[model samples]
Target: MSTPFSPRLIKGGLVLVDPDTAQVQRVIALQYNAESLRRELKGQESGEAGTDRAEPTRFKGVALETISFEADLDATDQLEFPDQHASAVAHGLAPQIALLESLSQPSSAQLRKVNSQASSGMLEIAPMLAPLLLLVWGAGRVIPVKLASFSVTEQAFDPALNPIHAKASFGLRVLTVDDLGFASKGGALFMSHLQNREQLAAKAQPVSLATLGVTGI
Candidate 1:
């Protein structure tokens, strides 16, 4: 029942997951108008021995650093789904709202309640919010990230004033070792994905020219 894979055909897109439950909450399959990828390096400036110029004496501040990126989501496809057809303007917005809301309210943990009476104060808090996981496998790279910011703009309302077309812009910060400490299923998977990516990158490196017989030039 599955179609055969072909290099000519492109497959897969951005995936979002609930960090607490490790469930695939949403998948963004449309082509975004724009997407940004950022990387940062940390270091200290040090003066050279006999020069007036100072150079950056860089070092890895964190074992793994976080990167941030922004992307836009649009609901303009008439063939998206039955509920997302052209006439179903409100329905077109449901999935986008669900995606954004899931990021904002991924999971909750219990906290100690404060009360005057000791016995009553010992109750646990109901909902302690947690973050969401963003996975991007585009550009021949696999990256696990955390949802940083999300904003949506609904436009093209129908006669009922329901949003028929909308665009959502969101930012994601790549997860690092610091963010993978949580013992949730998503957290564990995030860590494993990072490790696997690193391994694959290492394997793709070209060996030294000495390893080849034509290196005498």
Candidate 2:
């Protein structure tokens, strides 16, 4: 008997990269792929309405894009082997939840530095910059984004009241050259994403004007 072929599964993840060298710092892969992803795009109009007839079709730059999705995390499988997965048996999914939450939060090191400066009587501390965050859907799409919103609901818990199953929802605003500038690593990644979109668009089949009951404009 011949064995049936099984397809390989690709998981989506979030990647944190250094802004200067583009080195990947951390990768958080979704335990299970989100069933659906929601995306919204808003065009940047060049001028006010009725300012000029041609201005209606003009655009200032790339459209603002946002993506949202919900992922589920569960520790049931790991809980079967308590000795091997001690952390999962102890804290349930708290560590995993904390990892995602930390994306939007300033690091402890940065907070300590700020506190030190204040205690030393220093004024006008500079703002701390976070590492570039990238949403990786697949090989075709990897774009920089800012965490707009994040919410998690604990569905199931262990005996100690630690959450074992949870659902995490995230809203991400796609960062572009306008936000990051061309010199930054994030800006470069955004450009690559844009270019990939253009390539995909080029592969799309075109229809004739006659199909829409039009001979000529």
Candidate 3:
């Protein structure tokens, strides 16, 4: 073969058979002797092929997965490939790497849930505000307000009156001003998205129409 086969990289170790209990253990990276192992494996494959059967690649064992939460964990770090398998750590020790991975997935789900809730709340409440503000502003403009009262003596307007005995009634009211854009924007966006979805759905369902040179697009 003119092209070279890529070197097989092993993060987990070789499989070792225990004679006493008939159990297999993963030996993880005792060391990375990639070139040496490559040469040997290639030689074995080439020699074994003379028998007319497909040569099996070396190193088929359980995988040892690692986590890289920190910036440092990469290809350069060399940890010993254990001579023993998980039979030792299977009982007591929990790897921190796997624990971190477990939390990562749930954390992402939590953030997504929080974002959806915030969006829902914004959409639910936004429409009520705009109309309310508009109503308040309209009310303020239309209704005359005078919470404090002042009385002028009849002498000030007594051109043709006997003590100016006409009674006047005044009413005061409070109202909220409506801010249309602040309140209605969220609802408008939601409705717009819904309409867009309807449009997309209408376009998607197949129908017989004039062929425009785009058959199965």
TM-score of each: 0.54, 0.93, 0.14
Clashes of each: 0, 0, 7
Output the number of the TM-score-best candidate.
2
Report lDDT (Cα) of residue 8, candidate 3: 46
Q: Order the candidates by lDDT, highest first — what do you get?
A: 2, 1, 3
Comparing 2 and 3 by TM-score, which wins?
Answer: 2
Per-residue C-alpha lDDT of model 1 across residues 78-106, encoded as one tens digit per residue:
54565646544555466656655566553
Who is ahead in TM-score, 1 or 2? Answer: 2
Between which residue pairs do clashes occur in model 2? none
Candidate 2 weakest ten by summed lDDT: 48-57
Give the alpha-carbon lDDT of every model.
Answer: 0.57, 0.95, 0.28
Give per-residue CA lDDT, model 2, range 60-107, as digits (tens).
899999999999999999999999999999899999999999998999
Lowest-sum lDDT 10-residue window in model 3: 128-137
lDDT of 3 by residue, 12-126 (tens): 2222223234244323232222222110111223224347554366533212211111111121111122235332123211232232223213355566766787787754422
Candidate 1 residue runs with Cα over 4 Å from true position: 1-76, 79-87, 106-120, 123-132, 139-142, 182-217
